[model samples]
Target: MEVEADEEAALLSRPRARHIKKRALKNKALSVSFDEKDLKDFVGGFHKRKKKRRKEAELLVQEAQRRKRIEARKKRKLERESVYGGAVPATDSGSDECGEDDEQDEGSELVTSISGTATYDNGDMKVTVTTSEISREEDKFPSEKMQAAGTQINWRS
Candidate 1:
């Protein structure tokens, strides 16, 4: 019985040893063939090139940020100049025709026209200027009640 148990143990240990040896041989076979000098040179060159690329990327980002800041400053300057009608001395000559004030006035006029406070008569014979108050009163209440009270009341007083 002792000999039989030793034989079984030997059988199991033999396969494990063979498997380890095969794995070691496979790894050895797959090893890359590079001289020490060549390996070091390649690694050093790769790192140097990587560092240069990273520095270039950082410079590009900084340049973009600078340009963005300059553009924003120019926009703010133009806004200030246009608001003050170029009266401020710090205004740039190139920004004189920005028309920011005209745009604002045009926007206000559009709003007024939409609300019926302003009228546009394009050489037509019949020109009607519908007041906002009248339109609002008519919308809020019936025409008869608005005409009677000169105003509109939605709720009973």
Candidate 2:
């Protein structure tokens, strides 16, 4: 117990250790007073960088939302197309007599066989569709004849 006490006394009585003296000297050097202008000069650039990063983050979030909306629109379009049987006319060669008859006939046969039945909602509701049931006037507004006559003018608001 005496030996431990003497060791403790010796440590306390000694001059400050190297690390302690360095820390004390640094603290004393930094004790000088500074005004608002000095503080502003030191912190000005930090605020500008913070503002730039905040704007960039907001733009990224907006882009993500726009992408999600576009994807949803595309998915809905595909589903609607599937629900309507888009096949019978293609199989019947009498529909459109374009110059390339042979190639079109082969392609039409494949498409007609594949799209024979139109199913919706994972086959929960199944409906047999035929091209004759679909009305051409309902599908296309302002018929080709009207467009050729220049009845509708193109206007940009």
Candidate 3:
């Protein structure tokens, strides 16, 4: 027991080494001690890489926005086509077709141009296009209601 106490006293009397914490380099990161010139070079390189990465990210964002706009336009076009029963409307001149051409024109013809007007009131100009089916020649241009409202409708030749 005296020998054990002596050993314990010796152990306790010994000067202890201070605990020093060692810093580990993070994953994929380098810890470097450099002179002033080397630090300037490192900082310049880091800034250049940061700028390049930022530019690339911006380009990717712009490309995604462009793709979204194009997709939206395509979707709108598809929706319009579906709403029109899969056939797009066609433009029509003032010329009339024979009854024999009705069958041939059914698949192609959609809405014919009935009338259009451009009104300029106090520098505020507005243009309006009116479209309708022109199956019969006897069909009036302005219709009875428009004519009754004193509207001057002109039929294009």
Each prediction's TM-score versus the true structure = 0.35, 0.32, 0.34
Ranked by TM-score from best down, the candidates are 1, 3, 2
| lDDT per residue as tens, model 2, 21-93 | 7767667754678799989977997988899999999999989976765565455434434545443333344
Q: Against the true structure, candidate 1 has what lDDT?
A: 0.57
Cα lDDT tens digits for candidate 1, 1-157: 9999999998887856433577676677555776999989988999999999999999999999767656655666666556544555443454325633333332322122233434445654434444433343244467675586544222221
- Superposition error at 102 for model 1 (Å): 26
* Candidate 3 weakest lDDT stretch, 10 residues: 92-101
Query: Which of 1 and 2 is the better model by TM-score?
Result: 1
RMSD of each: 18.4, 20.8, 15.8
Judged by TM-score, which candidate is best? 1
Deviating ranges (above 4 Å) for candidate 1: 1-36, 89-157
Tell how far residue 20 is off in model 2, in angstroms. Answer: 32
Each prediction's Cα lDDT score? 0.57, 0.54, 0.56
lDDT, candidate 3, equals: 0.56
> 1-157, model 3: which lDDT tens digit per residue?
9999999999899877855445542344666876999888988999999999999999999999767655654564466465455655465321122223333433443333454445434444443344443333324455764664344433332
In model 3, how large is the Cα lDDT of residue 70?
58
**Model 2 C-alpha lDDT versus the unseen true structure:** 0.54
Write down the worst ten-residue block by lDDT for model 2: 104-113
The true-versus-predicted C-alpha distance at residue 89 of model 1, in Å, is 6.5
Q: What is the lDDT of residue 27 in candidate 3?
A: 45
